[model samples]
Target: MTSPASTSSKKSSPLESSHRRVPTACTRCRKRRTKCSGTNPCRNCIQNASECIFQVEDIRKVTVLESFITSLKRRITELEEKVGKKQKGENGTQMPSQANPTEIKDGVRAPDTKQDAKCDDTRGLAKRDSTKFDIHLEASTSEAVYSAIFAIFSQSPSDPPSPVRSCSTDESLYNDVLLLVPSPGLAQLFASVTFHRFSDYVNNVFQFLNCGYLSLEPLALINQVASFCEFEGKWRYFAPDAFMAKCCMIVALGELYEPAYCVSPRNVRLEPPLVDKVPPGFAYFKQAVALLPAFIIEEDELGTQSVLVVEALTLAAIYLRVINKNIASSNFSLQALQMTINMNLHVAPLETSQEDRRLFWAAYSLNRTISLRVGQPLLLSAEEIATPMPSVNQAPSQKQELYKSEIHPCYIQLAIISEDICKTIYRRKCTTQANGVSSLPRFTLSMLNILSKLVRWADALPQNLKLDACLTSQGSYESHTELDRNRRFIYSLHANYCHCIFITTVPLLINLVQEQKQKGSKGSLDNPNVWKIIHMNFEACSISLRLYESLYRGKLITTYGFMDHDYLFSIGLGFIMGQLFDFSAYPVDISKYEFLKSLGKVFNILTNLLHNGNRIAHYKCMQLLDLIRLNPDIERESTKMAPVMVPAAVPVAIPPPVTVPIPHPNDFFLPFDDLLFAEPTVGMINDFYSTMSVDYYNLTEDDFVLFSDTFDMHV
Candidate 1:
């Protein structure tokens, strides 16, 4: 394939070709090119898309018979000269007839030396006579096959270097390319690759996709699963796709099983913060999540398998309850959990039988509630060490072996899946966007998936629970120090999450800035990356939302488990936007109190919106943020201020569902355009991004290039 760089290179100008009049393909071939069973797709064309042309479009300098004879005779004479020269050099014998008169000179095959070995390297250097060419030939073409060939040739790294050039500086070209990348909206890319040439690939993969229950796979499904078990402190550079991988594995493996809850001393939360720890067996879980999607996804990225949301959440809850040291607060996860349930219920009731997917979600919600309700850590004490289990060698006794609930083959399957997801989510995250919405879920899910695996090990144990023979007499969890284990676990989890943020989020976000800046109004989904980033952005938000809901549902405040600092901060994003509505666009003029109050409102809404009725309100909250215009001084502020966080109370608490609806945030773009607020109740969020920092949001025309991405302005 052509490298993106090469495909953008300058093409030779028509003036550069001074000699070739209609330089083109062999006449014989052109006349019957379609019949020629040559090139990669020629045969395919003959049997299928029959118009696949084999002959090159442009006429060549030489005719078929003349070109062939010229080439062959030159080669023969060149060899004969070589043989004659060798004979003379070795035996002092001289060949007659001017050494076959085929030798070359001046690095060019002299017409007289066309058959000589001396001219071998220059055999094809002769100039062509183009003035005598015919002009009556037809202009035939190959569309599809050439398109594929163009893609390959354009992308191939081996191509000779050429000057780089944009097809046009008119900006429309850029907008067109930009439109081809992101996935912030509809599935524009669904037309190619797995769909081959249509959207059918997705239509074929999901029972729901074809039925219209969902369109364009939520893509966040995996992260939703990972969030429930999110134990990693905070994410670093994780990609949004990591979340999908993690969630998919859970649904594929543990969707229908009863979850086990056993806490491990070690756990990882979103990618990691700034710590390091000993690696655990469950780290493999992240790896698997990263890989599994390739098997099921038809697009370049994985498609949503919504079932993952239910299955993963259930397992993550069970694990958080059983594995890892206690956290400073359950508020982070609790708040998200409560909302997760409310959202699910609001979307569709949870009363359906176990056969229904909602049943799984309800079960998951139930499990988390039980885990968070606990006042202390299940596996770690206050000082932070692995808590001792009463069972043997971290194993069951001979009599306990007979019990099957935890040890069932299903549990083992879940464990295996968890291990894979943990590894997969983290591994691929290294390549995704960073700091942007696309990076969020990856950070969230890797941590959750890892925690889920460790926790499951305990739940899967036999109820009789006796130590394995090795640890029965000497091995014991009682010996480990809580503080030491906590430190180790935190460090490892921290390191990974940090990696996610730096490597994944930042790049993706930066790209988003460029993307949104370059977007045209003609079609949003046309750019796959845009759509991906947009979805990633919300999905990341969703992960945070779900965690807070879990904390709320479980009511596990003051417990050592997942912290809720992010929830407070995330909910605060809404606050900033709400504040923006009341304050001036000037950085200095924006009200600090308004900002604080808005943030608080966001948190309040987030906590309550988890209820069925408030989802529309929650949607409004997101839309409000999307409507926020940056303060003019935004660029002057340190990037540290970008996240705009408020210190969260430890053990964050959840509030009741919201019954009141919030007003839409003000817009800077054509404020009077009704379409902008037509769906004030709830609508997909749209954000303005820029590679270079800018205070403007909605529609300001400070950057001409930004508008150049304009479909409205460009044809």
Candidate 2:
């Protein structure tokens, strides 16, 4: 109060004080276009008896110059640090102490103002890190655009709610659903059959094919089955539906492998023929499917029981596939995948149990297999997968250790590469170019990469698991049980490997065929890339055909399933197409005899399957036979070729030939009968052969028609 000038300078102006006090406006006041008291509950809001809300201002307008300056400052600091480090290294001395030490603020180290000022000296020489700068700019631009759009469309309290109804149901409905569990006597019999015949095979061999079995503990599953068999009255338990479903699915799968269910003329005669009787496992599978809905509805409350539901669905899918119900199998596999994802199994945390990891990979492997087989899009991509491969060291037994250490990891890796193949080569965008010509160079590169991985996968196999080792040492096992397990495992592994090679190289074969057709000659194999493709396809077809022969002689072929049949058919078709188009134009001299013999063996296998009640096999066999008939010279050449040598170690026990009564020509075999036996018109055959060069997977049904019509027309 000594002087008026001093007092004026010390006190703030009225406008400045008012600006500080009114930092933001209340929503109620802003909506009315009136002045805000700035407090949370403003005077107007209090007077009107309405709640007041103040939204935080998150969007800050950044000028180009301001952003540039900030980037320049950051660049300068980075440059100074780099220079300091380099100078210290050159001088063989430590860096000088910073006058202003760094301090930690909000868990980030912040340099003092003095240290920042020192960085400004070399600002002109400092270069911007374009990679980081671009990323920052992109992030900022996206955020600003998003903020503006969000502000424009922000919801208000007065807005009405969405009209869509909830899907939630009463909890009582889930509990009230009837479960058709098997009686104790039947359950005991089925469980015994499963445990004795199927369970051991699954634990030792089949689990490698589809890893979902790894999630199940054999002893625990046994205990659960026993408990269920004894329990009475509605089967009350935690997640009872899922538990019963799992139990039923296990028994259903077991039924497929039982001796009575094995597809032979004897078995078919003892039971109803394929056309009349439902598949062996249908009763239990029906029960499993019925219980699945209740478990799915109450998935949230099930907790760890959710894994059992996935396992049940997976087993159901496998059983369905075994019976050749592919569409339904695909649906079940996809549902399991969806459930796995919902449970966060795909991105399993580090602390997740081994069982969970195994379950995740099983779902992943099965989905990938189905997608590749059906030409469907993948439900999950590799980028989204975080679960690690099942660990070998974690295996409780030496047998499990062998599989986990040697087979499981390799299989998972192959599945991943398979996914890559689907994405790179089969995806619609990658398959075609703007001008409509196939992208040959791009596809060729992808094929090479995938083949290299497949080669590595083969190379990484343990000594015992290798194809050559398993084949040569067939008599080396101590017992028939071990021999059976090893035979199935090695055969499956080798088959998958050959199939991958075929898939990788087949596109090139198609291209070569198309080019030869267009040019009207076996166009030059002078190109190394073309020759490489031919060699690969030749090797794959030869190995797979030979494997089929081995399986046939050993009586190890799955006569009922579509898998072996499909594999044999595809490889046979490849062989025929190669012979017809002269795929081995350059290398025909070396493999011609072997190739002819393999082709001849296919006929024998197909004939055997036909007698075993496999209609698909019958259809495939007839098609190949027709192709041979059309080309008599090829058959003459095959007849002259030496028969393939059957390994003496594997006893070729030819079962007593049972006469299979022929069904009426008009009789159908469920879904495939109509598709397989449909008469092909001239127009259909022309259209098929024209587009055959464009797609491979889509050609099976049409190819059947083409072959049948060609045979009929010729006869």
Candidate 3:
């Protein structure tokens, strides 16, 4: 090797020697493929007596590229970690480290044990509590924060929940943590006090569940109307109608307000006040009604329908119903509906600022309910109305947040479902009859379609709105109250949905069975063709009874007028009738005693409600109870008669058997025959309903069928 290297060196040019190399010889060394040690001043530089430096730009570019690659690697690692965490959650097997990564030990993050994770959660809550007062400070500094809490409390039923993204951390505290701390300052105290007072005022004057059916905030504005007695003579003279309308509503609502059930005694009776000068509630209501048309004309002359005008009309209608002027109420309902339509509320644009949707839905609900009661066709349909479901989260200022007491989306869903029901079921009934065409086929199909739709509707409800949710939550007055309201609303929907099933199936089932029987086929409740209907009815009745019992004992008094009452009465009657029917007459799936027990509970609840000042309920319950009492116990009578039967040898002449007309299974009379056939006829059952100003026709089978599904039908 030495010999070859010596020969190569002797052959090489002098310029190739490292000692004679230029300052840039690193390139030459590289180009010539000779090695140069990487040092600040290498052999080539030393040979040239010059300091060596590499090209800066090339080194800088390589350095930058390396840094970018490193950053990309770091980001990929973070993404992988996140995906792993998500996978763990999906698998339901959380890693100890991921459970509470905030936990640390010995200057290093530690994996949280089960006990440690719980402790960490407790600490987090403690931290929130420690900063409760700081929220006021934040509120004072940030108007957005203050408005968020106000927005939560101010939410009208139609408005979506306030969005929490704006101040999630602080606003979330408003719900989960009870803010019982006395205000640290006047600003805090005033805000809290004002909100609580306003909330109470809204609750007292209006029903939350009815928000979708009606927005009465305009009535709140009306409350500001100066009393005629307090106004100066000239002012009173100018605004007499306004003052009178306001007085009428105030007095009417006063008369209608019953004391809370807990405080009201079983037999407490309130007499209308006999003031020397002030008009009675009814007189005031009448005067307001008489003046409404002219007042509306004046408003129209001035320009358009002011919210106050609409409000007056709505109040008059509502009070008309309370005062037993249903025809007048229906008229007012129509007027309000027309006014809302004229206002273009049902076609609310995406940019619509105020929540007129509540007003529209309220009027629509009222109209739909009245239409059902009167057997009239629905005037509104979802196809014609473009109003979207009210927003679920309101953005007050920039930050959006949800209240702990957020309104349930189920209410909106129910509203839509109800509209569908009206369109599919009631509309078809009214239209087919009006057209004077053969309707059994169409009617039967509509009923079946509605039944399936209702079942699907029920199945599609969110988990949080299910019956089980109604049974949970036990602590905290505020939480309990919110949950109670939510539970009641959910149960109301459940009751309504079930009632629809009973209505849709009963007639169809009966008709099917009867038609089949006419063709020489036997029909019974146990028959496969009819069992679904019977079983469904039994289940619906059972659920309704359970809800009735659960709601009767709680602070949640249902405020939806007549809906719950009608449902309870109908369900009770059906169950009791099923129990009373001679067992040998037909095959029944439910136990008699079980139905009897449910009937007892229903009667007790109605009695309690009657004492709580529900005259309609009182009349219904009394009639049902009286009829039940007067009827002979068929089960007992049959058992006793069986043993006393005469032998064939000593048989006496027997008259031809007396035939009594038994109602078709689908007939409403099937459940309440006692009321019609008892000894001395114990007064007409229809007469009892008349005592409360309800017409006998309003309780007919058609009415029940139509109204039962008013809140849920799919077109």
> Which candidate has the highest TM-score of all?
2
Local distance difference test scores for all models: 0.28, 0.52, 0.43
Which TM-score value belongs to model 2? 0.58
Q: Which residue runs does candidate 3 get wrong by more than 4 Å? A: 1-201, 207-209, 217-251, 260-284, 302-305, 394-442, 475-486, 509-522, 525-529, 558-562, 580-588, 611-613, 622-715
In model 2, where is the ten-residue run with the lowest total lDDT? Answer: 131-140
Estimate the Cα RMSD of every predicted model relative to the unseen true structure.
29.5, 24.0, 30.5
For model 2, how does the per-residue alpha-carbon lDDT over 1-715 read when each residue is reduced to its tens digit? 3697457535968775475357588887777887676877876788789999998889997757644654675566566567667878899665443222232211112224443333233223433211100000011111111122211122421111111100011112122222323424334434444334434434422432333223565656655554544333223233336776776777666555543323321222322125433555566677778778887888668787788899998888777666555556678888898999998888887888877887888777777766576555578888988877777654445454444455666667778888877766554232334554223234455565677677666667677776656656664322112235455566666677777777666655544444454465554553344455566667676667655554544445655653676677667756765665664456445454255445555555555565555545554554454444445455555444424321112111322213333322111111111122122233432332232222222224444333222210000
Judge candidate 1 against the unseen true structure and give its global Cα lDDT, from 0 to 1: 0.28
- For model 1, how many clashes? 143
Instruction: Please give, for residues 265-341, the per-residue lDDT of candidate 1 as tens digits.
Output: 12211121111211121222333323433433433332343343333433333323222211211332333234334
**Local accuracy of candidate 3 as per-residue lDDT tens digits, 196-265:** 3333433443432333444554334434432322333112222445544544454445444322432111
Candidate 2 Cα deviation (angstroms), residue 103: 69
Work out the TM-score per prediction.
0.20, 0.58, 0.49
Clashes of each: 143, 0, 15
**Candidate 3, position 41, lDDT:** 66
